[model samples]
Target: MRYETRLYNALGVRLTAEHSLSTGQYEFMWFIGGWDGCGANDLAIAVGATSKGVDCMEAAGW
Candidate 1:
């Protein structure tokens, strides 16, 4: 579990440094970018977050 968390955090840092995206934003983009028609609620469920989180992402111009 520790190894997994470390690896995930390392990847998140790399992503943020290279692409200016947090892991959550990357996950959100990965899901929405693949689908044709995905709603905020769908993304929230997919990412295991609340719909309001998705709304915040939208507000940030995600």
Candidate 2:
């Protein structure tokens, strides 16, 4: 059997749509959408990500 992959951008990372969110991406989206008063550090911790990730998201038009 063979599997097909779809490439897309999440933040600035080129990722396969078939794969689930990375540890950080999932948390970032969740915190941003579900909570209030979320700061940069808060988002970083929530997503286990860094400023670069944020930059990527921003460039992606988030």
Candidate 3:
């Protein structure tokens, strides 16, 4: 058997928790579905968040 531990930074954890909310999770999913090959910065602008936050989401495998 194999196992892996997932680690999250403070911001990452916060973002994760926020995304767990019904509205936040829905928005996140909407963004993912609506993504159209835009750059991270562009996506950040479109989503009203920082690029760093987007990076965190990417790291979280969302």
Alpha-carbon lDDT of model 1: 0.78
TM-score of each: 0.63, 0.43, 0.38
Off by over 4 Å in 2: 1-24, 45-49
Candidate 3: regions farther than 4 A off: 1-22, 44-49
lDDT of model 2 at position 47:
56
58: Cα error in model 2, Å: 1.0
Candidate 3: the clashing residue pairs are: none
**TM-score leaderboard ranking:** 1, 2, 3
Q: How many clashes (backbone N, Cα, C below 3 Å) per candidate? A: 0, 1, 0
Summarize candidate 3's per-residue lDDT along 1-62 as a digit string, tens digits.
Answer: 12222322444566557764334544655776787775656656455465666566667666
- Candidate-wise lDDT, in order: 0.78, 0.57, 0.56
Off by over 4 Å in 1: 44-62
How would you encode candidate 1's per-residue C-alpha lDDT over 8-30 as one tens digit per residue?
99999998898677997888678
Kindly report which residue pairs in candidate 1 clash with one another: none
